[model samples]
Target chain A: MDKRFWVLLGLFLLMTAAGLLLGEARFVFANASLICLSCIGIQ
Target chain B: MAFFARFTDALARLRRAPVQLTSTLLWNSYFLAPWLKNVPCPGFNCYSCPLAITACPIGTLQHFIIIRRVPLYLLGVLGLIGTLFGRTACGWTCPFGFLQDLLYKVPLPKWRVSNRWAPARYVIFALLVVIIPFIALEPWFCKLCPAGALEAGLPMIALQADLRELTGLLFAVKMVILALFLLWMMVTSRPFCRFVCPLGTIYGPFNRLSGMRLHFEESRCQHCDLCRHVCPTGLYPPEEIDTAGCIRCMECLKACPHGALQSCATGTSCTERSHA
Candidate 1:
């Protein structure tokens, strides 16, 4: 693998760790709970 | 040699079917229920779809951006997927991509969009997915996205009377766009993927950096346009082999008569050495 691969992998790991620490999963669930009406422009 | 080539092509398509089928099922596993919904899938499966198993990353990104919060989870998941497989997710996993593939099989007169329009997707990524959402505090892409309209909007409207009543000019506009896209797909391959998908914009740049990559050997070139003909996206394989536009579908590999094009892990000669 090249240096770019390692760099990207490292960045991904850091972001994943940060996401876990920040409890972004809760926010993801919140975002997921209802259908995005604005997305479909229903609202 | 022709018989051998045909056999190889058939074998490759047979191999591709399982992966494509598995990805389709996994993305549409809405029946798996509440647990899967918490996780965001890599590409643009609309969360509003009754059969969607996971959240749409683009939608989640817009939500976070609209709320002025960091989309750490979405970014991390997308980054991992991109770095590993690049736009292979778009090629194999996205339901919208699958729909486009099916539509292209309708035996219509296929027309090729000029590659000049390829950069439009990046503009869409910047304007609709990012800039518009940040400025207007809304998921602007979703409002106009045909995928959302087809997967979530129409279905929900069909299922719920209230939603149907609420449908107005916006819904009509969305439906019009969807109809146009449907018509376009009959004549062109993956017009949305090439021109509109914001998720493809994000995942595309990783094609060269991904673990899986397309390798081309110039020594084996025969100058035949078989690769070009077999490519669903009509990309010139020799020039754009590892470009962001490539979905890593390996159609070129199956089409190459000279045993020139192959796919392998980055820095690995496994496909080359074995197939050569």
Candidate 2:
């Protein structure tokens, strides 16, 4: 792999860790579990 | 010996079918939703599908936009996948893409979607996923998405008859959009992936830098354009092998008679000078 590839991998990994620390996972999970009527094209 | 040979031949003919089918089943396995919905699915699938186990990354991304939060976790997961295999998920995992592949198999005339439309994906993503949702505080793309209509809207309405009460002009519009796209699929190789999928837009650029990449040996190539015929995204492999447009379906690799195109692996720098 090139230096560029490693740089991107680290960047994404850091983002994921930061997001997790910020509790975005819980936010995503909480939102995802709810079936929004708008998503299924319902009014 | 004959049986072993036959088995190998059958598997070869099957190619990506088995993996694609397995992925389609696993992602929409319904019962797995409780544990998996926290994570974003790599391909374009509607998380609202009755059987969907994981959240649609595009849909989740829109929710974040609507809520005025940065989608760091979802983007990280998607970015990691893009870094790993590029748009491989579009080829082998997307249930919606699988449906298109199956529809295209009908004995109908096929036409290639033009490369000119490639930028349309970026436009669509920007408008529906980010701009509109952020402005309206609503998931606009999900409202119009045919995949959502096919997997979630129709099924949910059909199963829960009471939902029909909520199905109004907007629902009819979604159905019409779905019908048009379905017809479009019969004559096109991958119209949605090539020109419309926001998830594909997100992953498309990574094809150039992904660990799993395409390597073309120009020294042996006669430019027969056989790869172009087999490519799901209509990419001419010689010049456009790993561009922002390539899904890394690898059909070009198998179609090259001269063995000029090969899938290069991670940790190995492709010595070929021409490729990006």
Highest-lDDT candidate: 2
**How does chain B of model 1 score on TM-score?**
0.91
Tell me chain A's TM-score in each of the predictions: 0.77, 0.90
**Best model per DockQ:** 1
Cα deviation of A41 in candidate 1 (Å)? 2.6
Per model, kept true contacts as a fraction are 0.65, 0.63
What candidate 1 gets wrong by more than 4 Å, as runs, is B1-14, B273-276
- Spell out the clash pairs found in candidate 1: A39-B142
The candidate 2 chain B region of ten consecutive residues with least summed lDDT is B1-10
Each model's number of backbone clashes?
1, 0
Residues B181-244, model 1: lDDT tens digits: 9999999998999988888888999998877677788888899989998887779999998798
Q: Model 1: DockQ against the native? A: 0.57
Worst 10 residues of 1 chain A by lDDT: A34-43
Q: Over the stretch B1-276, how does candidate 2's per-residue lDDT look in tens digits? A: 233223222332347877789999999898765678888988888888888888889888988887788988898999999987788788878888999899999998877668887899899999998999999988999999999999889889989988988889899999999999999999998888888999999998888777767677889898888888888888888989888878766677656777677556555534322231
**TM agreement with the true structure for every prediction:** 0.92, 0.92
